[model samples]
Target: MTAQALPPVVDAETWQRRLDELRAREKQATRQLDAVAARRRRMPMVEMPGYTLEGEEGPVELADVFGDKSQLIVYHHMWFPGEKWQCPGCTGFTSQFTRLGFLDGYDARFVVVTQGPIDEALTYKRRVGNRMTWYSTANSPFGAAVGAPAGGGFAVNVFLRDGRKVYRTWHTDGRGTEQLGHTFGLIDVLPYGRQEQWQDSPEGWPQSPTYSRWAGSEDIAARYGPDGGTA
Candidate 1:
């Protein structure tokens, strides 16, 4: 299909009427999402053991991750030991939350957890210019419990701290994690809609392979030194 064969242009009155119809559905969807979130808040919680993780300050316990806060949000990053680079999808997802300082005002702490070596994790952190806290879950049960395991996948885990004990309050994976990045949400409203072959775009709309071209740029690759150091 060609660009000239795209959807026909309509008059202003027709366009507004169609947009209004879509807006009504959008509002309904928003309310439905809010109702689902309310139900999520009422779900049962699971006790999380004192799992150890390597932090910038050395080995730290899961409770320590909260850092005087009552709630903790962990991004289960997919970086395995011995991999030359971290997962690009995980990196992009994390890059969206680097400046989430507002969570502090609501008594919440967020951190990225990975199974990679501490040194390599730090190097990737610098290369991506991340300002958020990152910890290595190497040799820890945190990854498996959170659904990321030792291979490659992304997940978000929420926890609540009571006194010295920590409990997993909620968790989400798959498309549920899409809410973390504005890029996906924003593109979702566009006419082309992510330009991915899987989307239900119009006949003539453009589409490409999804997430198959995320290799780090040349400048970013240069940040890693000969010894795999981000100096």
Candidate 2:
């Protein structure tokens, strides 16, 4: 049988020296993130048109999704018109966020917006163990207006509301939204660092196809349903 690979062992001094060098680079990356956040804070936003959306409680307007909060963070979940399950990647990524109510501390609220019909979206939401309420944009132009049109993929869109007026402050899709999911960050810190085929790793390191870790997330999602789990 083939033996498992591992990082090379080194003396205490050597390990400490190497770790210190990596820590310096890690600190620099942290500062760069801080700089980027400063720029995002100053970014210009576009005014969004008022539109109606279908909520679990029936029809509601753009500002209504924010509840009483001035800030709204919407996860645009990719939906298939007649599929039993929506995008597995989106399902797994979003279901991990079981505790978003804490956003209230920042005067913000989080919710899921999907392009499918209300009934279908809600069913999928429960089936995938989603905690956030799902709203349907099937009849609203808002989804497309925000760059998350049906069948186009998923997105993370941030909006701000002043009275009844709404503005989009930021939008991220593709790899740009990766940081929002905790799984990747946690995995990246492990010795294997995702062990994905696309990553740059030393020879003899374990590796597999990109995003092949969905099964692990499926276990997480399964625990979110009504049967047996706490947020």
Candidate 3:
């Protein structure tokens, strides 16, 4: 069957009412989310098994990486085959890590773990100029053992440790970006914004069909290898 004809455009006053309704619905959703976060915070404690992660100073235990911090957030970064490239979405989250002072105040640490060669990971780190730690799990079984998805995507995991071992409390998609979306932060101000490809945004929103690496006049192909861009 052919598609139905579109509805006529609403007047300005009607549009304003619709926007107010949208905002109200969003507020209710935010309250629900906050409640869920409170529940997650109460997750039972567990021990983190000791494993050496390849850090800037070579293999180091999980507890050692967190230093004196009480909590650890790990980003399981995807490393696609052969191109020596990292997930563009993962890189986007890493960009915000340096600016996060909440970690210090809350006794938490954040790090990105990838299955790429150390040199490639280090190069990506330098290119992005991020202060957060980046390490390799490509050769290590730490990622898979802790339930890394086989589909090769980004996973944000929150861990708590009791001495030498760490326990996972939460693992989520989209890098916990939903927490910052409503307040109109830097990500929302960007040309292609963050809610990823699944947002329920209005028509004519400036969502790119690909990552922002090629934003503006930059040539990403020469720098990020053949599999770069939306391919």
Top model by TM-score, which number?
A: 2
Query: TM-score of model 1 relative to the true fold?
Result: 0.89
* Per-model tally of clashing residue pairs: 0, 0, 3
Worst 10-residue lDDT window for candidate 3 reads 213-222
Candidates 1 and 2 compared: the better one by TM-score is 2
Q: Give the lDDT ranking, best first.
A: 2, 1, 3
lDDT of 1 by residue, 96-193 (tens): 66478898799999899888877788877876666678998887878897787888588999999999899998888988988767878877877666
Let me know the TM-score candidate 2 reaches against the reference structure. Answer: 0.93
lDDT of 2 by residue, 134-230 (tens): 8999999899999999788899999999999999999999988897878889988998898889899988889999877665434544666663323
lDDT of each: 0.79, 0.85, 0.65
Q: Which numbered prediction scores highest in lDDT against the true structure? A: 2
Better of 1 and 3 by lDDT: 1
Model 3, residue 32: C-alpha shift (Å): 0.7
Misplaced by over 4 Å in model 3 are 1-19, 149-151, 174-231
lDDT of 2 at 30: 96
Q: Ten residues in a row with the worst lDDT in model 2? A: 222-231
lDDT of 1: 0.79
